[model samples]
Target: MTTILEAKHVNKSYTVHQHEEHQILKDINLLLKQGEFVTIMGPSGSGKSTLLYNISGMDQVSEGSVYFAGEKISALSEKKLSKLRLNKMGFIFQHSHLLKNLNLLDNVLLSAYLAKNSSKEVIGARALRLMKQMGVDGLASHNITQASGGQLQRISICRALINNPDILFGDEPTGALNSSTTAEIMDILHDINAAGTTILLVTHDVRVAARSQRVLFMLDGKLVAERNMGKYNKQQNIRAREAALSDWLTEQGF
Candidate 1:
């Protein structure tokens, strides 16, 4: 696989109050290869979401740079960054973020429409195909309010795929779903990754993290440990992973 996403010495900080600073990400580094699925696991307030936001160009970093397909996204103007995000990356959030006024198909196609590079006809066809793969094809015309939470979530995934992004960044994609629905979403994500799309998922769920080929364990806004899941069975790997995590937490006296 080729390198698709790379971040070097990335740092981000937030201003909490007058002359007070909160360091959310501290000299972070990351590299993602094509067709690889990597999950980031961290406790609350550990900067998992902040890392995702910075890497995905949703927010500017305080320092360092992120390279996507040989382009430095950190240097792009806001307009160009928006284009890069819309055309090259797919995002699935905890909430589906679908428009209430539009049906499933319309919601998906609307992204392409706003991006200004793809045709509605092409986007609509691709969106339908993705929804069909997710088993939500029968509800293409249904509004989000009319759909079940699981259906809406699947539709969000389909929307993300409509543009055939170079990478998929999911921030707790399964966080709001029941176990069964979460499992379904996980299976879908696995299938999508198997089909050669690079994926970066930030999740607190152990089961979700175990599904990835690599797990990056973060603490206090830093990547303190990493586990290669390719070396062990899923159950054993998760147990070991959790054990290591426990050790880290215990060391911190938490």
Candidate 2:
């Protein structure tokens, strides 16, 4: 498999009050192969989200480097980085982050519009297709405030995939949903991964992590351990996978 994303000796720190420096990520190294699904799990403030941000270029690493599609992204100018993110990568956060002024379909089409890689007609058609695939096509004309949390999340997924990004970075994508809704979202994500989009998610839910092919455990700003569960098969027992992952996480002192 091809390596789509990599982090090498990455470190992230922030200056505190202009006097002290606090480290958020410590010497993190990782490689995400094409079409793989990986999850990061850790306690709050353990730097899992920080690592995601640094590796995705949403935040810059204070040291070392991040490479996307074999290019050194950490050294790129902000304009170039923005273009790369717009064209090559996708993001889904805990919140939908949809604009209040735009309808759901318009919101999903926003990034595609900015990318300008396709005509409005082409992007519109793709956006509608994504919305239908996510089961939110009926809500296309609705405002963000009109949808439930789960529905909004599905819309966000549509927005993320509008550009057909090579990789999808999710920060607690299902954190706010109920168990049933979380399962629905995870199923959609699993299908997306199966369709060949690499995914890296930061999550606290064991259910979410169990669905991933690999899970990374973080502690005190360091990557402490990793568990490979292999690819998910629909015929396999999900409960067993979740139990095994829970046991490993416990052993890691999570």
Candidate 3:
């Protein structure tokens, strides 16, 4: 598989009170392949989330570089990087962050409208299709407060896909949902990946990481280890996969 994103000897730090350096990511290297589903897992303050933001260009690196689709994103100007992200990347977070004023469907169409690459008729039709694909078409006209957590996340996913991003970056996307709801969301994500979106997620849940094709373990601002668990499908024994991953994570001091 071709490399969709790569971090070469990356390092990141911040200046604390009185010029003290707070190092977050340290000499890390990583990659996400085309059409792959990868997750980063670690304890609190392990730099997993920081790494995600840096590699995706949501934040800049203090040292080294990040490449996305062969472009050196770390070196791009803010304007160019914003344009690149708007055109090629999608993001989801622990919170849905949907606007309070817009209807669900309109919320999903907000970014597409900003991009202004298509007619309203075309974008609206695609919005409805994406909402339906996420099983949220019934709530298209409804306010965000009217839906469950899972439904809101689905709407967020629809919004993320609106511009047909080359890669989807998720930061603990299923963190706020219950187990059953999380499972449902994971199923939706798997189907999306099968349809060809490269996904790189940061998560702590073993069950969530188990569904991914590869899992990267981070510790103390470093990429410590990884596992290639293979493709996921309905017929496979998920519990067994989870158990095996759990054991391996334990070995990683997870």
Best by TM-score: 2
Which portions of model 1 miss their true places by more than 4 Å? 231-254
Residue range 1-254, candidate 3, lDDT tens digits: 89999999999999999899999999999988899999999999999889999999999999999999999999999999998898799999999999999999999999999888899999999999999888999999999999999999999999999999999999999999999999999998898899899999999899999999999999999999999999898789999999999999999988
State the TM-score for model 1. 0.91
Score candidate 3 by lDDT: 0.94
- Residue-level error in angstroms, candidate 2, position 199: 0.4
Which tens-of-lDDT digit does each residue in 28-116 have in candidate 1? 99998888899997789999999999989999999999999989999999999988898889999999999999888888777788876
By TM-score rank, best first, the candidates go: 2, 3, 1
Each model's lDDT: 0.85, 0.96, 0.94
lDDT of 2: 0.96
Q: Model 2 over residues 68-125: C-alpha lDDT tens digits?
A: 9999999999999999999999999999999999999999999999999999999999
Candidate scoring better on TM-score of 1 and 3: 3
Better model by lDDT, 1 or 3?
3
State residue 245's C-alpha deviation in candidate 2, in Å.
0.4
Instruction: Sum up the clashes in candidate 2.
Output: 0
Q: lDDT at 97 for candidate 2? A: 94
Residue 190 shift from truth in candidate 1, angstroms: 0.4
lDDT rank order: 2, 3, 1
